[model samples]
Target: MADTFLKEQVRARSIGDWIALPVLIAVIFAAPFFPAVLTSVPNWAILPVSDWVGEGLNWLARDAGVGGVTFADVTRALAAAAEAPIDWLKIVLAEGWVTGAGFNKVQAAPPLSWLGVTLAVALVALRLSGRGLMLLTLVSGLYLALFGLWVLAMTTLASVLLCVVTALVLGLAIGIRAYRSPRTEAFVRAVMNVMQTVPIFSYLLPTLLLFGYGPSAALFATVVYALPPMVHATVLALRSVPQETLELARMTGCSRAQTLWKVELPVAVPRLAIGLNQVVMMTLNMVIIASMIGAGGLGYDVLRALRRLDFGAGFEAGMGIVALAVVLDRLTQAAAHNQSTQAVGLWRRRDTVLALALLIIFTLFSFVIPSLGLWPKDLTLTTAPFWNGAVSFINREFYDPLDAIRTAMLLKVMNPFRDLLLATPWTLIGLLVCFAGYALGGKRAALTVMALLLFIALTGYWEPAMVSVYLTTLAVAIALAIGLPFGIWVSSRPRFHQPVQLVLDTLQTLPTLVYLLPAVMLFRNGDFSALIAVVSYAVAPAVRYGMAGMKHVPSERVEAAAMSGCTPWQTFRFVRLPSAMPTLLLGVNQTVMMALSMLVIAALVGTRELGQEVYTSLTRGEVGPGIVAGLCVACIALIADTLLKSAAARAARHEGDIHA
Candidate 1:
């Protein structure tokens, strides 16, 4: 009876299942006899795609042109335009105005006072949210002032502000266009997927090549990196505007532009604010990464400290970034939620009036009193000594156990998993991926997976790609293992929810570079360290999504399960788990993407993978190879994302069927 039922089920499967099952079985059976194909793609079969791309880019940069103007000229013009505002902002915030050049240079005026900036930030916070957020902003600003990081922090802030503004404007325009046309939206969505997935290093190369390596290159890259989320948010927010409001605008004889500006935009402001928050965070993150190409600010400080093996200095710089990120995040979030009626007059707005007045007063005073402009050097403190001491204590006392754990994990787990992936036939693995994609999403998905995998194989990056896969796979597994259960537990325990959520929020807000500090401090530099860093960065999504999934499970379903004589465990397992599966899968998708992103950064800590390829190419100025490797990483992310999303969709459909 069981055999008969299984056979009937197999026969009833979809066309995708039919194709995938046979391919999977054939690959399984054929692997042993085709031993030569088991390890890697043959050298003769590897394509010179990277070389071709490099040459194409070179031509574009040096020779290609229209109307006798070179591509380089255009890029330089754009870079020049971008640099003007960034330079002006930097001068206003940190550099101060100057006259002349070289030895003839003279300081004409000081930048805004650190005290004034701090008060301005606090007052803005107070206006946006309340006293609580104002206090937080004040503390963050004070940290920058007192830690001697005010200059670097302000420099970073300048770049961030410029990048955010650019991204927001561009994204908003593109998003509105996309919303107006399905074709445009589809194209933009596809481009966004690629843009968001490509490693940040890939962006640096073209910018570097075209812009000739400076803050302009960094600015351009930062804008590109941060623009996608804003575009996505704008489309969503605009789409979500109440249809009745739009109808009302139409009935009131409003033109299309008027309707959008007066009705849709006003209604969408809150959600648009959320997107603004994302753009700011992403801009900050990319700005730090862009530092290598001369974005120079706190990120450069952190990078230099890391290169010098000065953990304390790196920690301090990283913390400065953290403070900036927290302040910005809080301010944006507060702005998003602030819906209080506006005062009629500028003077009636006490918070803004006071903040502006204080800023003006401080600026005037700074002209006579230099100390009022920049915080006093003597008053600033160094926590480097304390951090260095703590690192020393840990190394002295905990080194053995930490080393033991690292060795055990590496020798017993990571190495073995990596070796297995490398040893496995690329053909077989590719087939399996295609099969999964087909089973989950039909023919289009399978083809997409196959093409992406084939590109990686042909580009001669398969081995390192596998290494990336191994590490990411392990990290994501561990992250899910840790996060899912914790998320579940917290979801059930309301008392634990807020604190845990707060921790996750803080973890997410810290720049990716900061995660590396402690990992490098403890594990030094290797795959183990990379794994630790990636895991730390990736775990938050898992916990957040898991908690959301569990919390959203229907109470009625649980009651029904209980009425059917199910125990609490049975109800959770049979009812809640199935219901939450789609969300959990989405969480897995997010976790994988985060791990891939961090893996690129982890290249700094010495992981030999596609990320390293991109990083190496960047250092060597090999645009083609760097881009190819970045594409390979993107391919990996897309594959995981597609498969998981398809699976989630399938699960939802199944659930819908069951409910019906």
Candidate 2:
């Protein structure tokens, strides 16, 4: 009886209940004065793999002759073949195709004129959305032309188009295969989680090796970065299709291919549209970053402005990026939901055909009037000076206050937090993670967490990893502080919704590089500037999710609280906030992920973290260091994500229990 009772007691205890006290004691005793080996990764234990990777890359760069057939010859041949379409697209869209030799070289011109492009885009927008979107599309094109950004904008557009198409096609193919095979799906999910978590910067080095530096390498990296979202979204959409519907299709004698193409795909269009939207946003986000790897476009312009400290030029390029992101986002979103609306006439439904017809006419007319083929140089305008002056005026007027805020934040918040994180021994941190993981997800998660932590430590990146963790944690805390209040205020007022959402959308979609310039302008370089840039990029999701959660609170619950004579604050605290807590937690997850993604970009402004390690590795063409540091960041993200998801699940269960 005593043996059974002991077994019962052990089984009844939660992981945390059983282990928390012991782990807490261990941390207290070991954290502050731990041995150097326990506190950090020792130099002798460092991986020698980086040197091997460097040697391998050098070997690949050199010519290897096999009976006069050199490796360089093969790579060059393949690269040129792959680049053919990209080169053609860029020239056709931006410079028009040229035909004829040497001195006789003359523009054969693209089939579509600037006028045609504008008209076609507007028509497509009209078909997808309505007159409002159509007008927005027209204005966006005019802005590009009038600002003398048409060529650069078109270059960026062509790159994005190629990347998006390739990513979507590839993602769909993989997603479909994964959907068909449960094992494949599981493996793909694991790979995607890592891929999505890895910083975009980490992708550049290996791609630079395989494709060499230029638009081709950048294109390859962008596709890889953007592909996961599409694949995940496609999987989700396909899986979401009613099993009954699929069964019915199968019963009707549909072959596997037929069921997929004729039944599943049609129904999956809306969900696939969501994936496409993600692909577009991700593609545009990478546009500027890719420029760093020799994929020039408007991103090149933004990079130049960053180096020169020209806010005006940066702002212009930034706006152009925002414009492109907004247009793509709107169009793709509209496309996703378009099928649900009432059907219209052929002219409306076949808008693509109409747009094509108009494009042909406009192109033909442009042959008669050559200026229509390109945006006229004499008509271009630039507002860089105005933006520069505005930034200057703001800096002069608010210098003291901004400086004070920056200084206090560095001294009071960032520095202490970073030092504390750095000083904490890895063993203690690992133990804490193990306990948390076990509490959240049982033995598998605990082991998984420990293994990843051990891997990071063994890579000799433990300190930099801690620095990244500190940066992410502090930035997220600040984002919540600001984002929650603002989100609450905006959510409470219906009148503020659209404008606030628009601004948030822009903030979310704007390139990471754009945030850097403003950070430099305001805080200069340091942890502070890095903090500002990260917060700017990350805060939007927090605000968005908070507002969305509040807005989604059950109406009846609010009414019940009111009837119970609760004050507004009391009602919000007792009713709305608790109900919305799960979603708000989800928002926090997104915010942390976003902040981690910015770590590499933050390093550019002198924030010492794993991101700096990754960036340094990239510049030196050292693959192992970049990858090891990236994995550390991914591990942090994975740990945080698992904990938060567990917490949210627990909250949901508790609420369900209370209701029961």
Candidate 3:
């Protein structure tokens, strides 16, 4: 009887809250139209968060000292320390180091002949995976050389290697420490969360400030950007080790270091290998963006092409990046999954010896035939003219239709949505967000979003924040509109699946900078170009999740639907879509995050959003403004992530209840 009474009270309260929700929303929406006193955040209430951050940075730059060294001095010294190895690597890989009397280019001397490098890569691939990857590596090397991009690709690869090594070392140390201490784990996790969410562009300026610009600064930014994933992956892998296994190590009188080396690390290899894969991918992703600060390579080639509107050249450079990414991705994945014995008798090590012997022979041959050491310039091919011609043809033939579509999208959809978002009072928007938070995750979430909104407002970037939200919202909406149905259609067809997935993979993995100019060429610079690029970039996840969810649906449920005599559309709409909704929402959350991440890049195409603010601050070296704007972006991402995650959780719970 007491339980029944409590249930009744709870039900009554739920009804009351439901009744009040509409009223609350109505007041918020109507208040904006009524009076500023009721709806708008007061002008006086806007705090100078950026100014405060600037002042802090200035103080550190001025008065902060340790061991008789000022902050700036310390930063410069650290920069100098980091630069030394990078310089050595740069020279060895592409720039040729100095010898007895003068300098010689690596390309001119060729450390390992083109044949040796190609053959060595093939052998590594063969050892790592099998014949297929060996062929792939051979093709990749030939492609780089044939296209006259070998040196440039190698230059990028050199920087990426340095960055990856540094990130891995630091990430592992931190991750291991966190794994051993709860307090350390908590602190690391908090920092990792911030680092992961903060956009890459935000890291650039502060790194430049401290490192004083160059490839080294770019490398520093890349390390900071890519380190979080490695740390998280390491922590996860370590924590996943069974307690029984660990306890056994303890029972055997293993010291902590001994246990970590002999037991934990061996067990953690597969997981760490996955982390290494992530580190490689992220390192590659940063290659192009890092170029903006003078970390030259294939990225510089692409950037130059974009500035010149040379679609052919840009496309070629972009393809080189894709090729490099594919090779690394495959190699790392193979390494992660490999479980071969490394210890063997010398009699069985003939293949390794033979490979090394071939390399040495090729090196000797290169001295006699220098052209073999480096790809002959006369033998290289250029596909840029072909690509340029194609671009020109498309522009001539489809210009009008493309222009109309671009204009219609801007005039009919994007502009109005943006204006509505920008014009809405912060109070109304905050209330709406709070309501959403409350509905999705109760009072705690509501409070969290309220705090996020208040913080954004205090930063004096409210309107820019709204602009980013507006762009992300529209981009995600369009992404879902296109990607969802495509995913559904493709999921039902086996033959189409792999091909579609391959394209999507390329779209997702291709660097963000690759699309900057292609977008401009198609849509011209404006919100349209930015939105187009963002949608293109963000849509892949939605489709990926949709297809995955559908593919994983229970066969029994599907068969039952067929037995019910439902039409294909009806079955999909009623059964499949419902099952996939949770996963789709998770994809949408990813899509939103991707769009926000692209915001700063989009600013290059002329979108005057928070991205532009961050970009402007970055260019002007205004650390305080740049950092605060970045935090605002992070705040926006956190809110969206939280609400969507809560919704996904609720959906999952509902499904579980139904299953039970």
**Which pairs clash in the backbone of model 2?**
none
| Candidate 2, superposed: residue stretches over 4 Å from native | 1-11, 52-78, 100-104, 340-354
Q: Across residues 476-496, which tens digit of lDDT does each residue of candidate 3 receive?
A: 999989988888788999999
Each prediction's total of clashing residue pairs, residues at least 3 apart in sequence or on different chains, is: 0, 0, 0
Model 3 misplacement above 4 A: 1-16, 37-40, 100-109, 251-253, 340-348, 559-571
Give the Å shift of residue 185 in candidate 2.
1.0
Q: Can you write out model 2's per-residue Cα lDDT over 1-660, one digit (the tens) per residue?
A: 997996785586554466576767867775668788887778888776656656776676575558888776676666667688789888867877789989999977663677788889888888778899899889888888788887888899989999999999999999999998999999999999999999888898777776788887888899999999999989998998899999999899999999999889878888998899899999998988899888888999988998898888988888888888899989878876766343455145467677888778877777888667777798778988887787788799999999999999889988898888887777888888888777766677788889888878877778888888888888899999999879988898999999999899989888888888878887788988888889889999999998998998889889998999999999989888888888888999999999999867888888889899888888888886787688788988988888788777867766666666
Candidate 2 overall Cα lDDT vs. reference?
0.84
Model 1 lDDT per residue over 223-336, tens place: 999999999999999999888888889999999999988788877888898889889878878877898989999989888887877778888888788788878888777665
Winner by TM-score between candidate 3 and candidate 2: 2
- Alpha-carbon deviation at 602 in model 2, angstroms: 1.7
| Prediction 2 TM-score vs. true | 0.93
Flag clash pairs in model 3: none
RMSD of each: 3.5, 3.3, 3.2
